[model samples]
Target: MVKWVLALVGYFIYRFPGAIAGYLIGTLIDSSFESNKKSGRKGFDTVFTTSRSQNVSPSDFELNLLSLASIVIKADGSVSQTELDYVRAYFVQAYGKERANATFKTFNDVIKNREVSAQRICTYLNSRTRYEVRLQILHFLFGIAQADGRVSSPEVSQLSSIAGFMRINQNDFKSIKAMFVKDANNAYKILEIDKTATDAEVKKAFRTMAKKYHPDKLQHMDEAYQKGARDKFQKVQEAYETIQKERGF
Candidate 1:
């Protein structure tokens, strides 16, 4: 009985430490792996900011869509060097060097070979990405169009078609377009003031207009009148934002 008891004690002692050591080793390995993976992901994200966007698969239909919009931007028989450069830069930023270059070549070839419909591109994008993503994509496209410091009519038309394809409500698209056009108006005139206006004067002008054209208050007016009021109000707000951006107010 004594020998048997001693043998059992010896077995328990060996197994217990082995189990504890294994658990400790497993936990350490797991923690180390997780930490390394997190660091790697952070590194990748940092690189991605500088690298071109390559998230979309080559087989995805958005590629053709983007190409068509770009072609339309240059449709006036005169694609400015600046515009071409902007397109190249954007693709590079989105896809990285090699892929971006390849995609650009494809874009060039596709634009020459076929006439892809802008509406179809938008529709495909809308079906692919969520509404919010579509909005962001549209904003990026707009940024590209404005990169040349001048937005062409074709670019505007392409954007309008994109908005329609994204299923952005007609009213919202109209509102946004009006805002863009009104913004192109003389900033000083939009504020109903001049460069001579003091900081206080600018602030007062903005406050008066913001309150007068508040969308909430416009609800009581006729729909058409309300839209007009809102557009005017947007101009005033944009004027203020512009001045703020320029540090004029």
Candidate 2:
């Protein structure tokens, strides 16, 4: 990201060769900074967040997320304290404790009483965020649904609706859903491959899924967001290993 920004500046200021030099410099800086961060010498960007929604304020993002969580918690006809606590804890970890508390307060006072419109919210979100980020949000909602240890039928229906509204394709929705709602040892389903897939095809699917779910892609968000991503990434790895063990290859 730094490289791209600097390379663009260099292109304007000094042409093609300067762009190359800028990129080389930016690479070193990015790498050194990443190393410092990993070693705990550097800290999180004090900026809590800005959504891809450039026009809307960032607090809208937090409010919408809490609204979605509320919808999921109430989907099963009764709210579970466990699910509510799970959402709070996740926010506390992903954002900060103060921000999470304020967001939840706003949800209760403003968004929670209104009819939750998944379609309207998703239409607003789909344009701003990348497909990958929406997928992560869907995964997070599923985490909420299953926080009490089981996803109810109503919750599943609500999740499916949200996924559709977010424009998540059927296959991607099924793949994530399989993780939260499992039956009959469905590793193949989780991988979005068939039991009869060729070994090469299975391997190919696993690689694609692994890359898609990699925590590095979400590293800019926050530690908790990356940790959530790792949950999905590990599931991909586990499915692959199960298949590999079964096939003995």
Candidate 3:
């Protein structure tokens, strides 16, 4: 309809030689407007699709995280308010206050249903998320397990199972576990070194571990994941310090 009206207007104007220029000008204006309108609709569709895709990605990530947390919290055959509180604080710290309540509700729903498969969730995350990001999530799970000042055997087992499903290396899994399991006694274990190693060897181990677990290495990650890496980084630093202090280095 608009095109026909524009054509008729152009035709009438073109009938007067003096106004031929006017007809051409009017046609050009109409054509430009029509082009812009189509482009505007295309731009809107692109933005809408991209926005929806972005929203789905983050929600999937959050849901998977909450599911894994529920698995860890319930692994000990019971739940503690302390652990729940720690998880809530973790969510708030990672996503900010605006998302805290909604995330907690999702956590509650996952726990209440009791049907969420930790293996499946971990598998999905392992495939979709970056390797370092998955490692950070494992670090966060350990923090949750230790929130009550103790990491129970069942919780450790659950963690191990999750790591396996995530395809995390056995050595990497043990190194992260050492950071949280204080009962392991050997700071060397945390650094993935032998107790009989020379001072030089220990220093090298510390540096290597430090580089591997440094939060700065993960700065490009989501803020929450970077925060989780910070916890691991601190533990690695503590372990190195303890070894140095004990050995009089």
lDDT of each: 0.53, 0.76, 0.70
TM-scores, each model vs. reference: 0.48, 0.76, 0.73
Q: What is the lDDT of residue 60 in candidate 3?
A: 47
Give the alpha carbon lDDT tens digit for every residue of 40-156 in model 3: 522111211222253223434655777788889988888877888888888777656654555465236446445678877876665455566678888989989999999999999
Q: Is candidate 1 or candidate 3 better by lDDT?
A: 3
Q: How does candidate 2 score on lDDT?
A: 0.76
Q: How close is candidate 3 to the true structure, as a TM-score?
A: 0.73
Q: Write the per-residue lDDT of candidate 2 for residues 1-249, one digit (tens) a residue.
A: 555644664565568986776576555445644665577642233232237424432344665777788889889887788998898898888766765665554344333345678888888777677677888899999999999999999999999999999999888898899888987656887788878899999999999999999988887776777888899999999989988999899
Count of backbone clashes, every candidate in sequence: 6, 0, 0
What lDDT does candidate 2 reach at residue 160? 96
lDDT tens digits, residues 46-107, model 1?
21121234333222432553565565555555556666676676655544555455445434
Once superposed on the true structure, which residue ranges of model 2 sit more than 4 Å away at CA? 1-56, 109-112
lDDT of 2 at 59: 45
List runs of model 1 lying over 4 Å from the truth. 1-62, 171-249
Error of 3 at 124 (Å): 1.0
What is the model-wide C-alpha lDDT for candidate 1?
Answer: 0.53
